[model samples]
Target: MNLKIVVTNGINNLIKEDYIYSTDLDFILLKFISNDWGDLCNEDKKFQNELLKNPNSKYEYRFMGVYLINNIKVWIISEYNYSIKSLIMTILLPEEY
Candidate 1:
């Protein structure tokens, strides 16, 4: 069975706060919604644009989920020290189960 992990802005923020990761994007896109999976895409346009534009600090995005109480929220996590993108990918793509 595939296990879905629930990630949230709070967790990401905490990671950054603890200095576990220095880079923190401004926005994240929530994509998936499942009690098991939680949130997925959480990146925003401006943050994405900055990631794409900059070459020095290459940014990478990953599908993540966050659990709130019993509900799950998905989000796209953006990782960059400075810069982001302007376009939202999941918005353009067709929804899949």
Candidate 2:
């Protein structure tokens, strides 16, 4: 599986440190400072659903509650992750958060 990785803008100022979110179908590799990594991981799914509903919304990074990867549901933190080469695979957004 091949996942499309998109680099958002707001993240540039918010996080000066380097981080990456790579996806390959069902696998997502998040590379960031171990400390900041945990905060955005398990956010409320309700927030993610609302943000993704509009495919064209201006919202860049927030909280991607729980999503599907290889048929498994997992938490996705938007902040601290956005490098292409570091990407591993595609990230599947769940129908209902």
Candidate 3:
């Protein structure tokens, strides 16, 4: 798939609404587009267990990955739009998840 990225208006609104910090935007884009990341498994029992253990904890879903940027762990969420051949990625604060 030719995965082009589109940061939707919702993500932009998050930034504008202060749900996502402005400074981390570049780092999010860099890591998301990097080839060294792995996909998240939504059905993983271990992952589900952890989430169940802490409902307030932040987590990422399909095609998304948890990454450590600047010594802080961040979640990057990616939604693929097959119709447009694009992937929409949004970076969020843990609390925002």
Candidate 4:
């Protein structure tokens, strides 16, 4: 996927609360989307559907997933803005969301 990614200001606040560096969030999102590991698994499909339901709504639309990037476990919650063609992602602890 060649989608553009933007991290929202709210995500910065969450990062600080989560004790995660902004750079790590950028790296993980880039790596995950750039890599073509395989077709979407069932879990991914479910998440995608959830994300698409109200992607353009005023309220944030979130889809949660766990990803391993550079041997680190990353919990991600993201919203896709179809109008702008971007994915806005936040890195959170699995228990945070």
The residue ranges of model 3 lying beyond 4 angstroms of the native Cα positions read: 1-23, 38-61, 68-72, 83-85
Shift of residue 12 alpha carbon in model 3, Å: 7.8
Residue 46 of model 3, lDDT score: 50
Error of 4 at 34 (Å): 7.5
lDDT of 3 by residue, 1-97 (tens): 4454445555567667776665666666675556224234445535544544554332223445665544545566666565775555666545567
Clashing pairs in 4: none
Per-residue lDDT over 1-97 for candidate 2, one digit per residue giving the tens place of the 0 to 100 score:
2244443343232223433233422233343211122224345434544555775432354544333433444444443234642322223333222
TM-score of each model, in listed order? 0.21, 0.25, 0.40, 0.39
| lDDT (0 to 1) per candidate | 0.33, 0.36, 0.54, 0.55
lDDT of 1 by residue, 1-97 (tens): 1222334455455565673232222233222321122232345434444444655432344323333321323234323323334322231111222
Query: What is the Å distance of residue 83 in model 2 from its true position?
Result: 12
Scored by Cα lDDT, where does model 2 land?
0.36
Question: Whole-model lDDT for model 4 versus the true structure?
Answer: 0.55
Model 2: CA > 4 A from native: 1-43, 65-75, 79-97
- Candidate number with the higher TM-score (1 or 2): 2
Ten-residue region with minimum lDDT total, candidate 3 = 54-63
